[model samples]
Target chain A: MLEDKNPQKTKLEQLGEFGLIKHLTKDFALQQKSTIKGIGDDAAVLDFKDNKAVVSTDLLIEGVHFDLSYMPLKHLGYKAVMVNLSDIYAMNATATQITVSIAVSNRFPLEAIEEFYSGVALAAEIYKVDLVGGDTTTSTKGMLISITAIGEAKDEELAYRNGAKPNDLLVVTGDLGAAYCGLQVLEREKEVFKVNPNSQPDLSEYTYVVERQLKPEARRDIKELLKSLEVQPTSMIDISDGLSSEILHLCEESQVGCNLYEDKIPLDPTVIAACEEFNIDSTLVALSGGEDYELLFTIDQKDFLKIKGNPNLTVIGHMTDKNEGAHLVARNNSKIPITAQGWNSFS
Target chain B: MLEDKNPQKTKLEQLGEFGLIKHLTKDFALQQKSTIKGIGDDAAVLDFKDNKAVVSTDLLIEGVHFDLSYMPLKHLGYKAVMVNLSDIYAMNATATQITVSIAVSNRFPLEAIEEFYSGVALAAEIYKVDLVGGDTTTSTKGMLISITAIGEAKDEELAYRNGAKPNDLLVVTGDLGAAYCGLQVLEREKEVFKVNPNSQPDLSEYTYVVERQLKPEARRDIKELLKSLEVQPTSMIDISDGLSSEILHLCEESQVGCNLYEDKIPLDPTVIAACEEFNIDSTLVALSGGEDYELLFTIDQKDFLKIKGNPNLTVIGHMTDKNEGAHLVARNNSKIPITAQGWNSFS
Candidate 1:
């Protein structure tokens, strides 16, 4: 349904590579002071001066990461930027610049690529990050996107996963499992459309969940929120590969154990409703359903009162000694070991 | 012939995503003091202190960038890193770190991925750059590689393409067109192999060209070479897309024209012989054939004596007024306008 029916399809080869890149990125003005040179060079020059730089990258393949049957090109481009930015944010740094490289097949027209870059421009504008440099080339098959995000922070202000200590309060931001549930809703609708192309199904009930999956935002506000509250996380990570998997990473890196309260796991109303309709356990969805783009962290016990009753922050659990091992405390008063059941592309 | 015929092949699914990355990069020791944190984290932390950072990225698709039938995974990995580093060196910066991400199909076993990483490790070791971070995931079809190289330099030490003056002399490092000629020899051998699978073709005569294509090196030594000689380039770029194309880039960026001497263009003896055997003009190959990874720059006329008669350097041309236009002064003394006949993947 999102595919363009316009007859004025501009072939990518007509303009060649240099012309295409110039045309696509002409309007991307540099916003950051650190970007000494943006684009139009062999490499971008960044002046971070006294601040430490954080770098993260990700590769998104068309068929493996997204299905164009339901996902739009604009959303894919926006999500690709978000995926890289989430890592920079997890480091408690301010994202200053990003480089986006894409390899696409000839099947896509120049207009289609423009649609994708429109979303990227929107993200860069909203996030206040400069587009530094990138490469554009043609692939043999489907589309491939690779993004590298660079951020900066003071050495003392940076957070690492190995800093969490015993008795630290585990915290989470916003809600979880919504993005995964949204994917499920989209997949089901795709099946329905496949059977009857003319069917007009009502999707009002899934608006929240569907939008969450299509245009999820990285938590760029939490850093400022914590600073205002005078609370610093001892350890932090983004929930991209699900809560359980990320929690395990924190535990392993910090050499500590965690007791996560099953009842305390945050879930949006739409996600709960979709879980009941889909006949799947909401807890399972919250634990193993990845791509939430929310921050999960641990703060000192002394900072617990500072964040108490904040709608955006939730006190989910606490850290324990290494010998206790990581576990999930059930509502029935039983404990179960937490394992990595997150999405594995290889599997 | 390069494909492994071993009986035992470990599936990539056996290690999963995180396990695979950890296994591949476990031996990569942190070499740069600027790299505060490398791998195993949400983002790699770099402390550039008072220096400016330079960043460049590239994406390589299997069928478009290489053919696995002739290109081994190790050389592909090594060459992918070189492509990005060439851009860093083009800026006259010291490369410090790199992040590599790849997406491959299930057809590649764990051993094949290991072979690729071995090449990456070797490049990092020789170049003294840290393997800071990367992402590994499964693709739906063939393989895809994306690399981002980070470098550091003082503000005054950096070279840009837009710094040339009217009287600056254009210079090139090493010889040109060998890599492109190497590709031609390899293609011919592939055709020969197709005609007779049992043929044991002798490639000794084509060794120099073939190795130039497969194992080309970025001129990391050029920065130090220029510094030692006290001759900084006024404008610089890597010769990846042919000398004519790169010269045009310098002219466009610096708002100047160029007059290239056909007789002054450097060509190795092996490249000249290969050109003759293939019945192609050596000048055309040196002008349009790319992937040389040699440094091309313009220096002030006063610094000409410092590099004169240097075996590694060749004064090929000189900058002129923008109205003069870019041209190649052929051996016959005819002026021909230079255009970009460089590789465009879309075409």
Candidate 2:
């Protein structure tokens, strides 16, 4: 049975500009004490009281970040918000609100924008953050999405990735490589769909992987989990531009070295399978895949037992002496120096 | 000796990223109590206290908002930041910090980037706003600049464009049409250069006009001036998209009509000469050339007495009842309805 495409979807012109914004952020709920107020004002109210705020911004250009051919506008919208929240999480703060600025072309009908906003709203609902305010404009070129996320934590509670000490345990939340595998599956399916008009993407088997890529979650829970575990990490950073690149950032900041254990790295079965099918090295995929939004922190050895048996937590390695330099050990017990291939949009 | 370039000039590479940031924002002193911390942290700290925060974003794409051939990199960078700061200033709040993201191709050598940053840093210093953080990356096409400015003020202190009431006075700061005239001078110079490669622009006479376009200020001084004058505008907005377009936005929000006297409209001598030279309607150019960044505000009739004698403040007209509709009273007594040819990038 063919799905019907409705010809009479509501046009953006039907509702005025303010109406569209109100409709888009109707269900967002503020979830943190630091958010004295969220949205409905000239600016989002961030009453950090005595706490410090962590702010970051990123831009995702159309045709550069994702192709609309296979990537749904809704997923694109959701992922756009995710990438920015990832930076907030990297600073070990709870993201409370975001400003989404989107510049769309005339080719995008009102229905398309609505679908995209629906995805943005859904992510907001799940993340428990407010949409607050943003600027909507017409773009001269392709679609442009600019997101700025604001978060808050106590001045003393905030964790930076540059405070690691020697012997601190290196731990990562959640397994890696699934998102990269998901991307591979999507690219292959896109090619297949281009060759045929009637074929639907065989995405059922790749659901886990695809979701990891298209609708990845920020580690908001990890912040809570770490709190309940009573473990204050000496240093923390989010895994975004590959684990290797992020590890280098931590090393550079701390002025120390690290030794990552190859055997200790965790991978899901679907990720393993996709790596083999794509002829990609699983280890490299895990290290350089990026977009995982997982927490990579250095914890005191004394607190290791608190999260020792937790399935979601994996002890990847340990910090080394300052002169040892950063390296990763292979399965054969040979140490290899780390190199970075961070995300470079300009290229 | 040809002084086209100086090798002894300060090089940006010598300072690096953090040093450049410190060098740029070292002089900006936070004037608002809500600004808990201006810079030196992951994000600029804001303690909104009992007020609501209003945030707005703007993105400028190369070849759309500017023509590099007619614009200096230093001025373009400064103007870009000023435009975004103008938005926050429009809300009548203190603009404390901003996040800037630029996408440039490899064609922009490190020196070119340094030039851009120097301009941005200079603006940050002049405006007294901190350069908190931003992302710099490579672009597939031309340069794209995205800026997000955050500001805070008490809830009642915000001067929304919708707050105007019947019989209110409409006022504007500084003169209009100068920027448009400046743009014309640059375009003419560009044409002259194209005809004869050895030709040099004779721009000394157009200094004020050129500066108005290239290094336009965000009217931060007006905020302080307004406070000193003890006038809280009932309605406020920045002049960017044109006087007609901005006045209409205020009318639509405030639900009031306005009667603008044609003779009272501010204009510089350079604007008059350039408009005459270009055969462009002075009124139309003043209404729609965009990028002035001056304060367009409405004050209650009772408070008009305070600013009536001030040189910087000019009374353009008075607000009328909604039924009267917005119109301009020409010299011949002809009434022309106001409409928006607002700056829409796609259009």
Candidate 3:
């Protein structure tokens, strides 16, 4: 539906693999002091002297994690990097380098790959992460992107999911459910375009939510913001798989149950409106809708006052004893056991 | 043709993505002192104090990189790891950890993934590298494997492609072209099996060549061997691409040239026999056939005596001034310009 007519199509075979990689990455200058070597070599060398290196990898497959019909290649590339970097930020690390490998089918032209790399370059430039090493190859069917994000942190500054204690306040950065609501708007627009090709999508009302989905930024500021507030999260995880699921992960990993208040869940106005228009419950959307890319964390009660009124932060819940189990206390004052409604690839 | 008709198949949907990852990697214990945290978190943490970390990544797509019709899931998993680790070894670094991410369609049973992970486990155990982090997801088509290897080395120990100078003696570890010949044998056998499924063709004669393709190992010993000999290579690269292409890369990056002697190119007797049977020139196979995973390097001429007559090493060529250009001195004393005939995914 989004196919461009008379698009300049340069066959990928013209450049081959090495030529394509060089052409795409030639402009990326090494900015990080930790990067001793970036690209060109068989491996990229990084010197994180006396610091802890955090590494995370994620794979995005076409028709599974994304659809090209709606996802622009640039946005796809940008989102792919964001997904991996979110993990690094979740560890309270400063993302320093990333390696992006992509496998494309013959259907894509060289220009398409250039657009994708442009997005990657933009992300690396903005995030201050060096594009170190990657492999480019061909897939039999569709495009597949695998990204590994590497970051650095001091030993004492890192946080893990297993550190939360009972009575700790659960906090989340930014509002939830906007990205999911944005996807709904896009899917509806896609359906409309399929029925009538000439129909143009009017996404003005969904600007915030759609941007949240298409160009979501990793919570790179959270680490600094928390530090400025003199608040250190006892446990942290990125909200990629919805709030309830992530809360459960923190609870299970830390061996402490959580009382997630449904009323306290933050939702953007656009998300609330979209949910109402789609006839879906906003609270349920916040609970199960994912791709928020927000930081979900817990801090000691003593530090709660330091961040109580922060515009970007919301106190959503509190930790409980392991025997209490993870539950969502609804506005109606009834407890609902939280289950993993996260997206399951196999299912 | 190699399908197991009555094999038990466990549906993957029974275990979601996280469950599958946990089940597959449950046995992988952290062996590297640099590894601060392995799996189960958002990211893996490593403390590479005062050492430079080398990182490399590779993606293997089904049908493009391997034909599962003959390639077992186990070998594919093992080979994927080897391909990435080879890059680390090429950098003269000790491989310390790897992150393996995979996307498989529902066509593969849970048992198939288990089989693949078993091979990964074996590689990790044998290589003494920790399995740090990975993401498990579903693809729309066939299986896809992406691995990122992380290693470390002292500042001066790492070798790069841009260090070869004029008069440096070119060297290679182990025999070449065997893996390419092995692929040919496997392909021929696959065609034969298509004609007669019940014919149990004995592969004893093709054992060496076939194993070279199916279960190739990265040259992890070459670094230690060179250290023991007190011979340091000025430049090095792994033979993922053909020898000619790798040599060209070294020459181009180092601003030098080389004259690779055809007669000195190491090839196993089995490879020569296979080349003869296939009616392909042994020289061309050794020059352009890739996936050898051997270390190709250049050492200063002064260090030749240290590696002279070593069984594991072969002096195949010598670096020349950049104005001389790269060429192959054929057996009859004819110098032919080298070209890249390495595997091109787009082609």
Candidate 4:
């Protein structure tokens, strides 16, 4: 990431606090009219006038969330913003502004931080969201990023996890399990690199899966697409901690049950091939392998015709009465309880 | 502080992610009517109707922001919220909600996290702000707290640091430097404890100063007081770094200069006594000592009479033409150019 040929590093202490903040955030241009004031103030001011405001925050820590050995700092920044924005999209709101805070150890030079912010700026621009205020400071260990995304929507258009009905058709936007397979590929490459420092592994075949893991995009377009298709999800959530975990959350909150069809679960061809190559079950990976920033929601049965045969969406499940319990209908016609074996940070 | 004599420990891995979050936040009641939804959703939803929204965030790293050796986890939690809320109050807005995301190492038990959340709950209750949303995750090192405070105010009632015009009166709420002196006392005690673990140092005389460091309160009431007194600040900021640094921020943002009076700077008797004991100049302590969490603001000349004799408010300076530059009027009536020697996290 260091493009400077001289390789002479400038320490963060040399720039001081204000100078560093100004340098890192100078290129961010406020885009949202709701953002009355951005950085350079005690707090960012937003005038959401009549729109209901939505707020979501996430914390990404090094070693636990991402390994810098394979993950570039630029992609890390982009992924951080995307993760928070995914939560906003789950609320069926238009993501408008975000605050990016970071705490880094002194080992990282000014250029490293600049590279990270460049990624953040790129994500903000691509998402059409304004970069608002945030804090930067020192950390005792590795870097940690905390992002809070703010969005706006009308009261009626907003979606909540508890709005599902018994007949709601469960749906997921885009394909899943690619990010997990991508992570597996990266881990294998890292192991190979450690054993032989000069070895260069060809990653061209795993390009799609690797990109999914490294630069997963939040389903920002899903909300607008659903609007145009006239399908309003009764309940919604982002698939962060895997599909099974999020489905269970929706069922529990809505006081209903879900019956997911294993055969209907969406998966990219790359993910299927990688699953076979790694001798792992693609169904299990789709159910429990997390980090896929896809939108998972349920729509009323009446709206099924509107979303039927949509290439970007798959109806993998349907809501049922609470007594039915959450389960998956396996392709072999056997029933299995859906368990949340998603990634747990603590363990 | 673990007070349970039995000392039975519960590992975080036992509860899992959802259980941990629910256990920590179960007692947080929504106090604000504006909080349409709190936890149990992808994002917290708020209906502000017409009031402008304000957002401020802060990241408090364990070693970088607070030394846990002397800082009780409860007080650390309380101070973390106060630090973020102070920024909102600086905007002349009432803090209504906060999202506190914490990343903790595996070393911290459930009870320790409970103690910290108790402090957070206490602050939220006392301030009448709702604990709307947050993310709790595992870190590779010590604990880090990132708090995002959301507040609201009418567009016309809001204050920004760039509103001060020439001839505006510089005002501050409460005393400064006590938090800094309080840190000195704590550090000295920590050193003493390091030498002899069994030694119990007498900190009775330093009670006020030490408490200022351990549990500093944001001036939440000051905003209400200004409204009640029919006075609005032309420009405002919270003193997180130091007086000199915050003054320079207002000066730079407003495109004006300031002349602060050394005599008018507010200091408690405890701070003065502690400064003498530490063999440090009280003026320098007041100027450069950070983490005061006091409000520094400017008022139009007509409002000066309203705040002049108020014990809670002190007029320390006035805005001047930009060419005059920011300076401090010493006790000897000498002019000294003020420099921002605020606490640099990098250093």
Candidate 5:
């Protein structure tokens, strides 16, 4: 939440554009050798040499993508960077640089922006990515953030969403539904606080889910893990718009159908508990809950044994022929159509 | 100016995210040989091989950057892409691809977005750049556009802001103050329309300035022009934040002073006429008015004869020793300190 951490609020207008940007990015040091130039230039220069470069961009708007009342600016900044990096990881590349652009209104003070940038700086330090270039300006209302992540990978190692083939073993890393359940918990607490401003609800029990919602990390290590195991994914994508929506994206792009087993959809105990307490179906929650920041990939059946017993990876489904259509094989032996009932920004 | 061109308004929610993106970008054909993959992927893949890559991003918020009351959505879209490409060109690189991200409120119909994208498609085609990737999301208030442009250049050809030295001839491409004057005209018409909705002000007399504002083009040909004449800029930057601000940036980065001649600051006849009509000082307008989108660079004095008397290129100033300080030499022989009185978005 936007709790005032500093008593002295510095007006953004007083600092001016150049002054503000200089103050915010003064501490960020370039960590990547590929970054030929960082800030203080018309454009950031990079030399990727022989490595193929990968790029992904995401735009986040206040009220639509986040609520500052329940989301801390630091966590929001960190999550925004994570979201873009997740895409690069999904492409089986090593993220090396990022450009962050933000537009905020007068309602936000210089300290508030600094807080956001500090979070961004922390993510950059942890991920070993250089902050290359960005644009900062004023918005008429609310806040908006756009991040473009740059990565590098060899030609043969790169993965694409359209590379899946029939009979490939569909796999997902970590667990699903926690982030969505965490959002539910935060929303519930926000409603409670709205009714009684003085009431302080204990959020200790929902720690895992809340953390998943606010401070989720991208699966940056999965590529290295797969390489070490000598397993190359045929196709891969990140779980951002829930399992159903992402699965559909892979199926449609690859021109194949999938048979996702409901029983195989991994769920943490905390997520299962939250779903039960909230009176929602766990399978539906797992399928429709978004923002897991996990990797979903398809591996050739011959390479399945390398990841078969790995605790972090789970074989959730198998790619099928196009005529089979995309379906969910329920635990009760009933087949149900898989639809993109995930988070839709338009809705 | 956000005028209703289509009676049929299709809600963006109907098509969803994937459908909306597919429908809007279906007409875009990848023209850049470096682009290995485009949209419909976790990330766009590019292969620049040995060429160094340059990246620059810009964020434009409606109401803050443009007043839709007189600015058409198509022009805004085109201008947005141009703004990012201008930065790439400032680095003396060839723009190869772009990723555009937009956050729009529900008030906008799908057709309006299509209109905007058509302009973007036109710019991409004209510039010979590929629309590689982007993100579309909902905004709580007005629209916000963020574009990241990717460019490539040989190492020896790249120019940076810190390359200038004492005695370098300061050169600028094309005229100045036109875009800023154009904005003043648009704002005036908008105010006039607000008072009397039926009034139609004739903008034919302000064609050059109006076109400079609405359909501004990034100087994509300037790099080739310099190359043809065997000239390389010692330092370069685009004029987005007025001549004074950019001159200051060049001076500070290059650790040099400048003697900018007031009489030599290029101003078109239309700009001069508008200044006379508006009763504003033409010199101040050219120096402090922003959004010219012209290339300003410093070249070795030895190359002066090659660019001398060229209609497109103007030698306005020369870099001086750092102790001399950056100054403007007036027509009356009085010297004045050049300060950044450019457009401040924060203010």
Candidate 6:
């Protein structure tokens, strides 16, 4: 039989990313009653007696993910912890614990790791997440950092990416494009430093933008504000892959359309200034600029009145029927479709 | 004033691995009631109401961790799953779930990942760990693999590295050194194949040994057998870093020493034959060879009688007081001091 001549014996270079994940997870039937969700979304949901547990993970590698020359270990540690915790906050859950793993070669001395952990422990204490469990090992090239964050939420409070309805008001927290601009600024500074080692960086005005990239904060406060204000978002996602990509995610999951406003879109002055300097569109930065770690959500019109005057929440647009299509209302009232220009690491 | 000169910014390579862990983890305060233990153990323990939870992680890299040139992707996937579950089994707990993360470049296609995942799914089915969640991304270099495993156990029934007591029987389950020897054989075969690709590898006699290195099984059966026989080990650890090293870990934690019988040390017939052919001492292999994935545990004298005649159990030696020092009883009844030749990833 042709089946006897197994075709899979070839090297893994033939399978690609999606094929591998699909194959590895085909047989993983969720056996736990508490596992309301498993691996399909931003975070998996577990139904505990009092609250649902939300879990997420992120991996950071030196060189491939970050450059030690520009990326400080402390920021790297803090940023790693923040990225995973942000996934929990995306579901409006309060992050409670985190497991951090580091694999480094003898290339890094004890002090280097201590500096890294000092940042991790500092972030843990700041976020109130217990430094739970992790593994330490040696690598041939550089350090590998992986963090898993776990959070808890009541069943009523848990948010999903699939519940948006037509006429639901779209709300985004804080501003977008600042973090994206922050990255451009850092890259420019790095390039300038390479050419002139004696030149001092005149980054006196981009403090907020730089911090947004280096030590981005999870929207833990928004969860509390929403609880106090009694507003539950029907659908939500984190701004990890920029506003455009995140909006695309919400559309696909909810199987509905969106109509966001260009004028109402939040943009910091620094973002506008940096956009001009980089000769890139400010809207594109907001659309495709990632690593903001902000929350994007949709609120029912009924709760819009309750959340209208709230400073932390800003209304950007509304959801629509699937056939209406996902679009953006430009400044001149021109309509255009929304799309994701996410970072394709493979490319 | 000296603190202002913070040497905390020193390069990571200067502090080394252990120093970094100690520095980063020092300030972590355990806040969860369920966290019976955190880091600094073979595995972290989470005390649930009905059962305890065990957690551990390990990272694999390109050149340092595994050479894909010789290691098949399926075998790599299998080894990754086996190593994590092995830690849970080390805690005398049943592994429940695991999260696997991978970083690959575009050089890999879709079908190759399917082969890797197929292997992972196979192991999950055999071990019954749900493939909870994972992060997939691209790396600039070779592939990176990270696996985290979670387990469940009774509060009082859990075994720790520090629980061995004086006069307790120091017993090791299954055979030792075969996995390490198996690795050596594979390395040799790989080298030979490089010299002559058309020449067939004569590994038929070392089939079991080679398989042990590629796809070692976590002793899930041992946990059930011990439970059915009502034998609760006072102390337990897995043979990932050789017997002498594991024994030292038990003694260091329990604050006790031990003696083992050289003749009583179990060796698979294949392992013994391979060691002889390689001109390596069988006793040394039994002592220092690791990755057996067999559970090495100490049972109190009263509990030893239940397993005395069982084929799966062996009465290798007994734990002794701290003053006695760790030693092994030779075939001639002479005592030889035992020194740990454990896996030192840091070096």
Q: Which stretches of candidate 4 lie over 4 Å from their true place?
A: A1-7, B1-7
> Quality of candidate 6's docking, in CAPRI categories?
incorrect
Q: TM per model?
A: 0.99, 0.88, 0.98, 0.98, 0.98, 0.84
Give one digit per residue, the lDDT tens place, for model 3 in A1-347: 23334456788899989899999999998999999999999999999998999999999999989888888989988999999999999999899999999998888888888899999998999999999999999998889999999999988889999999999999999999999998999999999989999998889989999999899999999999988998878999999989988998899899999999998999998898999999999988888899999999999999978998999999999999999999999899999999999877889
Clashing pairs in 4: none
* Steric clashes per prediction: 0, 5, 0, 0, 1, 22
Q: Against the true structure, candidate 5 has what lDDT?
A: 0.93
Please give, for residues B1-347, the per-residue lDDT of candidate 3 as tens digits: 22334356777788988788889999998999999999988999999998999999999998889999889888888888999999999999999999999998877888888889988988898888999999899998888999999999998999999999999999999999999998998898889999998888788999998888999999999999999999878999999989989999999999999999999999899999999999999989888889999999999999999999999999999999999999999989999999988877788
Candidate 2 shows a clash count of: 5
Q: Comparing candidate 1 with candidate 2, which one achieves the higher TM-score?
A: 1
B3-88: candidate 1 lDDT, tens digit per residue: 43555888888899999999999999999999999999899999999999999999988888888877888988899899889999
Candidate 2 residue lDDT tens string, A1-347: 01124556554545645556667666666666656545543445455555566677777877777777767889888888888887777666888888887766556666787778888888777887677667666555667788888877766667776789999999999999898899889888878878986897667878899999988888888778888999888888888778898888788878889999988888999899889989999999989998887889998999999989898899999998879998999999999998876564533
Worst 10 residues of 3 chain A by lDDT: A1-10
**Rank list by DockQ:** 3, 1, 5, 4, 2, 6
Model 1 chain A — which ten-residue stretch has the worst lDDT?
A1-10
**Please, what is the whole-model Cα lDDT of each candidate in the order they appear?**
0.92, 0.78, 0.92, 0.92, 0.93, 0.74
- Give me candidate 2's TM-score against the actual structure: 0.88
1 versus 6: better DockQ goes to: 1
Candidate 2 wrongly placed segments (more than 4 Å)? A1-46, A138-140, A194-201, B1-54, B195-198
Query: Which candidate number would show the highest DockQ if scored against the true structure?
Result: 3
Where is model 3 more than 4 Å wrong at Cα? A1-8, B1-8
CAPRI docking class of candidate 1:
high
Choose 2 or 5, whichever is better by DockQ: 5
Error of 3 at B108 (Å): 0.3
Candidate 3 chain B, run of 10 with poorest lDDT: B1-10
